[model samples]
Target: MHHSLSTGTPLRVQDMHKRFGQFAALDGVSLDVKGGELVCLLGPSGCGKTTLLRCIAGLERQDGGVIHIGSRDVSRLPPQARDYGILFQSYALFPNLTVEQNVAYGLTGASREEARRRVGEMLELVGLAGSEKKYPGQLSGGQQQRVAMARALAPSPSLLLLDEPMSALDARVREHLCGELRQLQKRLGITTLMVTHNQDEAMLMADRIAVMNHGKVEQYGTAQEIYSAPATPFVAEFVGQGNWLPFERGADGHARVGGLSLRLHGERAAIAHGRIFCRPEAIGVNPTVHEENLFRAQVREITFLGNRCRMSFELNELPGHALLAELAPERMPHLASPDIWVSLPPHSLQVFA
Candidate 1:
């Protein structure tokens, strides 16, 4: 990586909007990415995450909004005119060209000797040091991906745009390369924006997550914040595995969860109607010690998932409603019976309106 590229500049997208005929792809989207920060645009399909990335990369022209890299406005510029590096999910490497050539292709502006040096450095940076002479077909999936990364970074751009870069790889390989990618991004100090629908991937690699829905940014915060304090009902259900139970506002300005009345958190507590969402792990299963928010339920289903067991229970008070709880394997010994009591911590139940 070049010395100048190591010090990333800030990125700002203000009130971005894009449309394809009758359908809106991006609607009033705005985001801020600090220097050397990694932000993931996470959402389900048709949520406009990739569209936002393309707008930022200048691959797609937005109908309205301003995009700034540091202090420059390059929204109108074409993709090649902008000073940024991009990595596609396909690992778009040339089959005919050797790894060395693919990496050096971006270094057209540098002297021959300088380009060679940069190519070697980039390959080494991505852990593909001496395999430069081999073609993309000769390398493994992970290695080919690395070569694509090397090619992108060889030019030393300030911003790195990744469009589902790891979605094509196998689970194990994707996990391993995700770790490497995070480390390399930190080491090089590049401002990165990645688009991934995978929740785990976003949680593992991003400093902050931008959850989008229907071409709008639903919430923007750290992974913990997005997961624990979702701003909208869509965010609560989309970001992680959770249960959204029917909820109604109490006359006392609290929330009624089945038979229990608990105080809601944040601004949603004031809303009239919504669902109270809670994660399976947040619901305690037959606690060893007594705790608040305890509720009685009967087990409806059980699933063994490695170190933890996922058990579904139907709330005794709320007919036709079920809650999922994940407990350790040791806790399942006594929980084998259908009769079980679970506790929902007040803090874990987020009222989404």
Candidate 2:
């Protein structure tokens, strides 16, 4: 349940557990979001991502563990008292209210002039400055979402929670807006936690990603760490598609998979059999003579994705694994032939614990 944090940390979640009747929504999850960090809680639906966010926001109660904000215990604190701002899936704007009014709604005690000024600034920050006079219905989907963000950020709470912020938008809009959101967060230097099921979104937006599964954080690390060296089988499979090969590690840090031997970075890979994660792009297509760790794979299917093509292949005698490769359109010459020799470098082949 111990979580990593800066000294005298900004926020920490220690062994948090939550359940709904018989279903465990969060199980012994521990993580930390440092000050001004944009950490994304990433996982598939029903993986406890939203539930974990709710716990932090004080919207949901945990049966176990402590929630700390800036070293203070906030586990027992109520939502309003915790001072965290939350932006849900819907914009939740009042149709009758102008964008300005919606953005300034929560600043109830402030003077009308002050509220209006603050709302104007928030709108400018979210690229909706001129749209303040319009109602939510007058704006497009992206504009409404921006208004929602401005509203959530108006109070200037200590922490910000965004639940599937880009989920409601179309694919192209989602991609563009995600970059914008990341830029906004960076400019403001806000400490924020976002929940998303989109792996690409999480990888692109997060400072660090916490991968949740079965109501627990199965693996948590920087995007590269999680992708390159996944600690769990789920992480290896979920972060990106990989061809896993079963092989016994030798004392000198060498292993064999599909009859191809590899020399590893650290020498202890020979102790026992473990899974080697071979990333699609990492597998060199139609390798040259300099390459020695080559495998014979049969192309099962090939899908053209504009500039690139996704080729699914199978090794003649490997178990519990399938090889997926991505090839540039220009590099399709050699791969058009059957039974390509794929070079899987030892460095690209990640070994799991």
Count of steric clashes across candidates, in order: 0, 4
Q: What are the RMSDs of all candidates, in order?
A: 2.1, 4.2
Q: Which ten residues in a row have the lowest lDDT in candidate 2?
A: 1-10
What TM-score does prediction 2 earn? 0.90
Q: Candidate 1, residues 136-200: lDDT per residue as tens digits?
A: 99999999999999999989897999999999999999999999999999888899999999999
Tell me the TM-score of each prediction against the true structure.
0.94, 0.90
Best by lDDT: 1
Q: List the residue pairs that clash in candidate 2.
A: 10-70, 249-269, 249-270, 250-270
lDDT of 2 by residue, 40-129 (tens): 898888999999999998899999999988767999998888877788878788999999889998886899889988998899888887
Which candidate number maximizes TM-score?
1
Which stretches in model 2 have alpha-carbon errors above 4 Å? 1-9, 248-265, 316-322
